[model samples]
Target chain A: MTRTEATRTGLDLAPDARVGIIAGGGSLPVEIARALARQGKSPFVVMTAGEVDRISDFDDYEQVTLRLEDVGSLLPTLKKHHVTHLVTAGHITRRPRLSAMRLNLGLLAWVPSLLVGVTQGDDTVLKLFVRRIERSGIKVVGAHEIVPELVAAEGVLTKAAPRKSDWRDIDAAHAAAKAIGALDIGQAAVAVGGRAIALEGVEGTDGLLERTRQLRGHGRLAGRTRGVLVKCAKPGQELRADLPSIGPQTVEAAHAAGLAGIAVEAGRSLILEGPTVVARANALGLFVVGLPAAEPAHGK
Target chain B: MTRTEATRTGLDLAPDARVGIIAGGGSLPVEIARALARQGKSPFVVMTAGEVDRISDFDDYEQVTLRLEDVGSLLPTLKKHHVTHLVTAGHITRRPRLSAMRLNLGLLAWVPSLLVGVTQGDDTVLKLFVRRIERSGIKVVGAHEIVPELVAAEGVLTKAAPRKSDWRDIDAAHAAAKAIGALDIGQAAVAVGGRAIALEGVEGTDGLLERTRQLRGHGRLAGRTRGVLVKCAKPGQELRADLPSIGPQTVEAAHAAGLAGIAVEAGRSLILEGPTVVARANALGLFVVGLPAAEPAHGK
Candidate 1:
């Protein structure tokens, strides 16, 4: 169907129509926006509070501010701009206070979901967000869909490839990371010497790394310095929002935290500043590899 | 089978036969030894080196010290005492250097499982240990099998019961803890405000609690302190070894960590110093509940 036809009827349509980007924290939203704009499509961005959304850089798109609690106005805003497709990038770790939300018609419609979402894990809430947007006649697209280059490719992405020993750590971390995702706990897990040293929690990757670093050798035995940081999509995850991403910052943090390398899920993970990240990791003598989807069967 | 009959041959038998205790760290081994002695059985104790196992108080047991690397002596020692049944109690977080081992015929016999065990998580190694002992004509029993009082009881354990809101945190922590267990990563998980704040890693439950305390409010949004500490058995865990245990130390830590309560898998978990644990929990106004085996179906 034509874009105008889909917009006028306020019904579902292919992603070829107008894309609305709901930007959260991090540089992902800006990248998604630029990618969409480069494709000659207009994107109306709803910037959440505490996000790195400086929308003035975009000359072809419109921008609006929306607190997480004020999610009610999101639907009307999308409808007002004739948005038929939507994209959510970055993350929202802090939950919004229910009482503080504006409680508009759209938000009111999702009260049940939001109520359940409050006590649920990050994936469940993100899934709810996607369902809410899709229910409003907007199709949610992963930012990677708009820019394939952002998605990590299979195999090594740095000069220093993972050694044979590191593969064990990678597989271990990958399995633990998947288990974390399956439980909707988090996306990342740290493994040292084939043992999971830490799993990402609400405190995030940085905190997980920091705790691992501090507690590594603090146990009865010394913790190994070399480990792999595996970030992968949860077994059941909403791909549109919060697909695990790695940037130069992650590389620096992993290095600082004494990890030997970073391993991300191939084709499903995002690697921002890919070349810079690779070069930086190579400089730090750290490896960055994208693991294939079909993980080797764990022998244990 | 009669106790004497079972000890005569290299065959598996119930723990009612002659029992041997492999004591690691902490006071649990002492408790188990005492329980077995009270049951009119002469228990042989192999205290792992670096453990706090001073068995002078025991009048009815033979004791020997063995370094972790000297695992080869374990089987021979068990057979010398006519130990047809065994129990492993307490904790051991540090792994031994395989190269430093004084490999004996028994340790060499189980070298394959030990090699596999070295790279696997705690549960796998514990499972291997159980298999090694059982294969050597000795049956391993959980410490709880000797001391029924060690197992936690159902429902609120202290005067202070979990308030309605704490249930959400309990469920969240329980799910995360189980996931940690399913992956054979760790035994405990802490949640606050419906978010998994920390997961037990190699650092153990105490370390997990400490990290949660330090990183609770350190997240993007202030993490709620009114969550729970849930310690459950890992999926497919060999109940004979490393069943999650909490005690007065746990109560003190939970109180200091500012948690609302502590929840544990009722039938599968151990409560060391139960009266003191309950008393401390009550004094701190923190709830300690033995959660039922069946978890409420997670809404997510």
Candidate 2:
């Protein structure tokens, strides 16, 4: 749906429909909660026990902390508040340890799947976890559904536009990022001198940029600049959960890596604190562009 | 040719064919030099001004040092010594600085290509550099030509062979390595839980493994082990230069990264100091295997 349509219909839910924000660490969850509160639809916040660091952000709303092991209590708590929809946000740095889990009635059935999923990659574990939640009846919605403006807009977002050489690096990095994404590996890549110089793996975007910085005077990229960082959703990825994102911190990382700019897939990526991100990019003399949706690579 | 046939023919060059070793920084060049010397072919060594760390290794042979900027002098020096065959070994680490160059008459003609190639990737620079030498009547040969036994042998080389799960990781990492190689990026990748976990960038294999080590308790790889590191020649790569290689250092890196094993392409990859590498792998309880040459990825 178009941005306007999504914004309009997103808030048109039944007055009795309650939303539950399964907040993890990061400002994203607080932003989503604040947006919902502005619409007179204050979400019942459910923060993971060890993951969430700040408690005061949800002081104005009804919130509860639950251990990941006690995920069994999640649905019942949401059900108690008559929650009809759920929104998941932020990062879970490590997979839940199986040994620490004290399986309750709601979690017992998931024991087998959890055992298997815990041994897999993040995407697989997340897919199974979300699937379990959806099977219980409440609908899972993306944060963008609640705040359409959070979705990155197409075209350059910062005052500094990408130069011709920067555009070439962007294209190379985009292709490399997409290639790895196809394999369910990562969503980010960096290109220098019109060739891919780095690919993100499980280490994530921060690690990728730090590595690019370390390679500055090394072979292939010596004395090279005007490189670009490209981030996009993995091919056929679950949008409600892990959409690739950039924020003010990302702008700083890009600048530190000596990159000319950052480009993220428009409409498919999240630009958290969009104004702040753009302002930082502008101040640092780095371009921040949102790429138009690309055609499926395999179809090409 | 078979390994035995290659060894025989490698040493069966014309009696008047004077060999040249363009030694860089590594044990591989020293190993190749010793192998050639053993065959009664005392090679004339050409060392890059800053690359070679040990002059004593070539003390028994005729040698000269030339700056990469004065590549023009390379051909003249080789011709002065009547050098007919050339083998490049080890690493240059960084691209030559253009500002340091003082273009002589011969180098003056190569200004355009050098200007362009210097701004490109390592493969491009190496290709242009070698092509220029070939144009000057010197035949470029692989280090493997001088020491065919240096080529990795097929099957498990270490006492510890890979488990079934480790083999799965090897397959996944091999595909990833080949995919990146097709882009002329790098030749190594790591896989864990049957998924590509890390890819080698300009930071190279050591950096790749270090990154993997850092990611041990992170999202996807939390408590995960039995990962494998895969290295192979790039698709349609210039075999005479930069064939993927692994030595005792690689074994230690893989072990430190908690990888179960390493697999390198047999017949196409170098196993420097093979005995020491195998012994180290065995002591560390990590498998080191040589996979037979693979069919072109596109042909599949």
Candidate 3:
């Protein structure tokens, strides 16, 4: 919307540009769509049926539903709507089955890559998908590009600032997050005391927080509290899509897990609704801080 | 018990050596005790009250019970029992609370380190604990030293060997396990479709497997199977305590999680009741292999 603080990808949203959203299951897509609509650019919302959560929110906008197996037809559909730029958002919980795919002539060329990418890490699959869309002449942009205000700024956003002990945890969790990200594993980690206690896997951030919550008063972690949850981008990650993010739900999860705070890489991560997230965190007595991107140590 | 083989720490168990086991809550301690008894060595079992699970199994041996807070008195207690060799086995589910600790003169000297160590990773706390015991003239040995046969051999141990595709998962999971281990985080990881999907955290291996099981049919992991679970010792880890281990329970957990097989670093990791684990794996249609200690990848 009006070149919201030059996108990380250097994307320029021209006045006559048409936007298409490849929506998945999350409120982020809805937020992105709302931001575009408010700026007088109604987006062509596309949802994979059974994978999207906020279907009602996109009802006012021109929308279409496609099955997971019909992802092969998404390019043609976007082209038909004359989409100039694209934003991929939210989680695709339903995987595309090889047997169910309707591989048309055009889709056959890329189906092999899709099949291989699906078996790899989430980022690999996302990169291949984005490349396919970009190759078709529709530039793919991150949802943060549409809502710059949602990007977390450097500092503690909530009323409760992290304590000195929480800073150690922040450092520990950040290192673990980066290590896993480098391996294309996941994007979140929780640290208590002075070391990592939980790591995000394919189960995602919510699951990682839930596991940490359950670990309280068990084993060596008994009586341990004031942990920190950190989410950050993979080192040298593609900034177009799948950047690590947090929202009001993240604050709730961290609080539920008995964590002192939540930290995200400033400017590299998205805050779905900045005010709502801060308000929720403050209400829950959890500090939400945006950490500076760590400097490369000895050029690893 | 006489030495079965040269221990990783070069520990020698003489026939006259009076053994004491600081037992925690798992079958491993029991297995070690049984191995010692089979060799006609009656071990003195020390069980932390409310923390040990296999109490009945040690009734025949000279045993003592103490509260978790009384860990400070353990050195003097070992001296009283004339224990020359010590082994720490199993999981300590209950942490020693500082407020409840009976910090006598000897413990007071190292109490600060204990307090700091407990706040760090498991290895840090364990190294501190073992060093204190070693300072008191008792030699500590790994449980694998008691029964050399318990150490996994470098080969597939079940009827269901890993397929060619599973090898990729093995490499990926091994790399992830080593990465986390290097940070003193944990010792196990699960990789599916050529990338790590789950990692062991403070919740332990069983919890990791359970989380992996719950992750099935969710997000990108839907319909994925034949994953690999890998466990290995931490890089440059103190070998006398906390050697990564597996047993029949591990086999069951892996099978239940739809994993294709289980792998542990050969010689560095233990397979409690090895024959039983292999039989269980064979029956469950799962493979159990012991990978040779990974060569340093271009000198890490």
Candidate 4:
């Protein structure tokens, strides 16, 4: 549905539409809760312990938090709240090591499939969770559905436009980032003067930016000015759980890295506090562009 | 032809036959010279800068070394040497920056295509150079042609076998390494307890090994007694140049990293100084396996 149509409808969220949210570690869950509140719906936030913070806030929102391993409790919690819709957000910084996670009977039954999916490098666990929620009669909506403006658009978003050389570096960094993403290795790569300086590994984007700065300090960067940082969703990735997102902090990181520009996939990416991020980037003289990744290069 | 057959047949080395050797930074060139000597042929070695050392020995063997960027002079040099067969081996550490290279006219002409090819991460620049050589009437041969024994075979080579847990980590590291290789980002990845700890970048494998050791010393890898290091050729990689090779030093590195095992793609990977490498790995109680990567779960 179009944005205007959806907005006009005012979103038919039940006053007590027990929304189930599989919370990760980030402020996204809090933002999601606020959005749900606007729709007159209260969610049962199943927060993944060690990932989520501010547990007391969940009480204020009339929600509950749960450890990642408490899958058995999750189903009952959803049923208790009569949750008709489910949404998940936030950053699960640490993927529980398969060996370390203690699985209960319900989770044990799904272990074989989960292992197969993970071994295949597919987000099988998340998919299975979604399926379970649907089977329980809960609808799952795109995280952006409640806040469409958070979805980034195609075009230059920063006050400072990229210089010609910055554009060239952006182009190079984009190709490099996609190459890395295609391999499911990382979402971002930092490049300077047509050479890759740092690749994002299991470390998140911020860590990668910090490493880029360090590498630059060691005289490994291409130019004296900061290089370009490019981030994109992996080709054929399961976007619901881990879509690439940037915020004001990302702009600050870019400034610290002395980046010439920051380019992210348009539409597929998220821009938390968009105006603030752009303003910060502009103030730092860092160009930020949301380039269209719709037409991904063929045979990727 | 079998080695014995080729030896008995006394293969002809025409004065006009142009051979190209894409030399990596290692002692493999010396061995290549010995093999070529047996055939009464001396190949011209094209060494990448900052990779190979002691080029003076090549003069004694009637061999010539050229910079990677001197593409304009490469064809003429091959013509001068009457080089017909080309072989590439050793470690060509990925450069931190490409802009510093002084691309000659011939290379400049191919820059656009090369850029697209390189950025696509489908083929290494070394492989691209091989294609250019072939187009210029030079035949590229597998480095193993000179030392067939170096070509790794399927199955465990070391006496010691990996623990069950080590096998799991090895599998995980193998998958992760292939993913990294597919991106043309790196060839090696280290994983302990199913968590990727380090990825090889511009830093050579030895340096990476040392870093892993240091991290282990700092108690970062406390519970994980042994990590698995997986190295593989990039997907659709050109076998003629820069085929991944593990030698005695690799085993030493694994021991230093406190790694339980090292896995490489069978047949596709090279085992330089095979006897010594296997003996050392066995001595260090490290398992070395050459498993076929034909059906690797991920693609380049």
Candidate 5:
């Protein structure tokens, strides 16, 4: 359906429906806003400062831009917009310097808990945030509710399947990555010749790939044979927020790093711009395997 | 026992019996040679180049110095010296620089396998080497066999016990260390406030500790809470060779890094100059736990 037709269907608002979008950094929020409009809901958007910009495209949306610590203002803003159903979307890039945050009264009370939870992993932080919001009488929905097609699925997504040996490396990488993730460190690990070469840390995936490439250049990487990059969710990871996601950029990075294959937790991950990602991976002869969260095969 | 009495005992070996001491870098080899002299066993030392200097003490004894890849020459030297049982000791300070090694005929056949195994973990590379030695009819014995008292036993070695919370960080560090070890990357990990801060790589323990201290200076580490350092053997490690070892120097490094606790795998790990190391750690209020390989527990 056309964008105009979807918006027209949502022109008449339902009496009790209340939707609030906690927009972070990305295009996901815009997509969610469009979806809400199609369902006769003009969602209220709470855009985080330094995280989100541009809200003029939303047909009937009211936007409030504030810092992460401005929960007191956020609650009142949601109340003012008659929002009862709250949803959070997009990336929240970590700002290690916390002194700059302008925490309000509500967030001030949460500072200690938030600090502890933040070190526990992204899922823990998101869950804690959700709990705080719920305690404020708001029900939270999954980000995928507005864009269900974005969720990844199980099986080989690329044209070429990983070789048996490459599968072993993938399985090893997955286990290592999960262990690393459990420590709230990073989300990706590169396994070459059944050994972990580099782990993703605060530097993010691009940096991790670059490090892998450098190691390869130095002949330190045993990637004379095929290697695998595995991304998986930590045990007890929250699915609604911060599920490990990969995009076209990730494919380009993997190809440049000479990775033979990539494996990600299926259903629990997002394949942003899936078609472009798969096309790039295929062009570079890289295999992309989507693994189910349950009964994840020891790909080897 | 007195040197003369020890020499009189059956522990003293006949001059004809070949004993290969695969000497690495350190004063341990010199000390070991003196101990062997007291027992009347003049070992045939094979010292790695850039690892040990002055095989002068072995002038009266059979000795040969070579690179790590001189397996071909090693077999002939051992055979010529009538070397039957072999003991490897001391520290090999240099990491394997794949590009620099000049492999001989015998090593060339094993180089590929060794490379693949090294990436898998230290044990694999050590085991592959051990297998080659065995095939050439040499018996590989534990380095601690020369000084049985150096093998650490399971329990708290220091007067100080880790605080309850610090123990959690120790446990996490131990697990992290083992995971890195399994990857054949490194043998040490430092964790503070339940987060891993540093991992050992191609660098030795001292370098690892120094790097960690620098990172801690970045103000991101647990404030005022000293971290725990854990060292252990890789998973499925070969017990007879390349066991994780600690010494008085390790304790000094730990103190310099402001570490609160140290954990090493019991029985499988060697404690060079154990009394001095423990005395220093205890004086510094650092808990030194000699943990059993089977019953994995946090330092607490």
Candidate 6:
């Protein structure tokens, strides 16, 4: 659907329809909740334990904080609130601690699948996790369905565009990031000069930026701020959840790391607080752009 | 050549052939010099500036200290000593300051190629570098020619062989290291659990090991000392110079980083101070093995 159609005001839902949100840590979840409420749909918000930051004025909302292992309780809570749609947003660092989990009638059925996800990478785990949620009768939807503007649009979103010399590094970052993502190793990579200097491991994007800073301090990087950070959706990623995300804080991190700009895959990544991200990047003289989506490749 | 045929060595040259050694750094240069002298051929040693540690006991030896930029003078020095074969050993970090350079006739003539090399990656630059030397009519040979035992033999070299669980990490590292080397980005990579976590950049192998340790410390690694470090030649490398070299120091570094083993490509990489390296790894309970060469791929 066109973005305008996706963002049209009013509910296309049944009169009694209520949305259910499995909020992971990040501002995106809060934004999604507020957007849904602005349209007069009082969504049920279930905050993931230890993952989310503080949510303000949440007393009236039908929500509870639960650890990842306590995920089975989410269905009954949604069912209690009569939720028909489910959306999960933000990030979960890794597999939850099984010891702290409280498995219930809902989770006991998916024990085998959860075990399989533990052995696989985060992408596979989230894929299976979301699939299990879908099997519970409530339809799964992407946060972009609620906030279409969060999906990055094509082209530069900042006043500070990449310089001519930065294009090679930009393209290099794009290709390298995709190659690593194909292995499910990472979704972001930093390219300096003409080659990729760092790949994100399980430490995630912020860790990658910090590592790049360390490499630069060691004279490993060329003596300039000509590098770019490229983030994209992993090939065969569970699109309904775990999409690559960046916020204003990511802009500050990129600027601090001496990167020239940030490039995220258009239409496949979340740009949380989009205007502020662009404005902050522009103030710091860094570009924020959205490139075309990544193509699939067979895993080696 | 078969492994045995390659190791069966004696000087395969005319009786008048005098070897010239382009020694860079490390004990390998001094060791190579001593071996050649024992065989009755005192090779002319050109010590690259600021690279070699200490070449003690060299009062009677014929050697000259030359800055990397003074590379132009090497040909004339070889002519003066009647040197017939030239071999560059040890490590030359990068080009020297142009201002400190005293360019000789040959180096001045190859300024264009050197500039082109400067613009490209190490593999391209090294290829053109050896070509320039060969064009000057001096036959270039591998350091392994003088020290055939340096070439790593197949299979485990230490008392500790990789366990079945370690093989997956080894293979993962081998494939990941080669993939990065294919891009001329690095020669080594570290794999933990089943995925590659750190790839060598210009920071080299020690830096790669340190980065892996940091990732592990940050809980990015699987919960165990099961990672392996893999080193190999870049596909289509100019093998006469810059073969990947690991030494006793590498064993200590691997042990310190809490890895299970180290793997180098058989028939291609150099095992500096081989016996000592094996002994140290055995004492540290770490395995050191030479993996077979990487196979080619036609897949895109």
Top model by DockQ, which number? 3
If both were scored by TM-score, which would come out higher, candidate 5 or candidate 6?
A: 6
Candidate 1 has an lDDT of: 0.75
2 or 4, greater by TM-score = 2
Model 5 lDDT tens row, A69-185? 565577778877889888788766643345555666765756765677634545666777677777878776765545556567778988889887787788777877876777666
lDDT (Cα) of model 6: 0.75
| Alpha-carbon deviation at B231 in model 6, angstroms | 1.9
Report the candidate with higher lDDT, 4 versus 5. 5
Q: Encode model 3's per-residue lDDT on A229-300: one tens digit a residue.
A: 999999867666787788878888888989999999877888876778877887889988888876421111
Give the number of the best model, judged by lDDT: 3
For B1-300, candidate 3 gives per-residue lDDT tens digits of 012353222235676788899898878889778878777788999987887888998888999998877776788889999999999888786677777776588668668667678657767777877778888899877776676667777888788888998999999999999999998999999999888999988888999999888888675776567899999999978777787889889989988899999998887888886778878888989998888886421111
Q: State the lDDT of candidate 6 residue by residue for B122-213, as single tens digits.
A: 67877776787788788888877777777788888888899986887888778777767777777888877666777676677887777776
TM-score against truth, every candidate: 0.82, 0.92, 0.93, 0.73, 0.73, 0.87
The alpha-carbon RMSD values of the candidates against the true structure, listed in the order shown, are 7.4, 3.5, 3.8, 6.3, 6.7, 4.4
Model 5 C-alpha lDDT per residue in residues B123-145, reported as the tens digit of each score: 66677777788888887766656
Best-fitting candidate, measured by TM-score?
3
Q: Kindly list the per-residue Cα lDDT of model 4 for residues A104-159, writing each as its tens digit.
A: 77667556655664434334456666666667677876566555666677888767
| Cand. 4: chain B TM-score | 0.83
lDDT of 1 by residue, A100-154 (tens): 7775677778797777776776677778878877876787877766766777888
Show where candidate 2 strays beyond 4 Å. A1-11, A111-120, A295-300, B1-11, B109-120, B296-300
Candidate 5 backbone collisions, by pair = B121-B184
**Ten-residue segment with the worst summed lDDT in candidate 1 chain B?**
B1-10
Task: Provide the lowest-lDDT 10-residue window in model 4 chain A.
Answer: A1-10
- For residues B1-300, what per-residue lDDT tens digits would candidate 2 score against the true structure? 114334442556788888899888878889888888877788999988888887798899999988877876777789999999998998777666677778688778677677666445566666776788788898888877778887887898878888988887888899889888887788999999888889998888988998888888785465576799999988877777787898889989989989999999887898887878877888999988889887431110
Cα lDDT tens digits, model 4, B72-182, are 576777677777777777665443345655766766766764566434443556656666777877776777666665667788877877777777777777766676576
What's the ranking of the predictions by DockQ, best on top? 3, 2, 1, 6, 5, 4
State the lDDT of candidate 6 residue by residue for A1-300, as single tens digits.
Answer: 113334542336777787888887778888788788877887888888767775664555788887777777777777887889888887765455566567678778768776775445667766776777778788777776777767788788888888876777888778777767777778898888767777776678998888777777653343445689999988777777777889999999988888999998888888898778877887999998888775421111
The positional error of residue A165 in candidate 5, measured at the CA in angstroms, is 3.6
CA lDDT scores, all candidates in order: 0.75, 0.81, 0.82, 0.66, 0.69, 0.75
Q: A1-300, model 2: which lDDT tens digit per residue?
A: 113333342445688887899888778888888888877888999988777766688899899888777776788898898899998888766666666778679778677667666445556666776778788888888877777778887898878898988887888889889888887788999998888989999888888988888888685565677799999987777777787888888899989989989999887888888778877888999999889877431110
For every candidate, what share of the true interface contacts is present?
0.62, 0.59, 0.77, 0.05, 0.08, 0.19
| Ten-residue stretch with the least lDDT total in model 1 chain A | A1-10
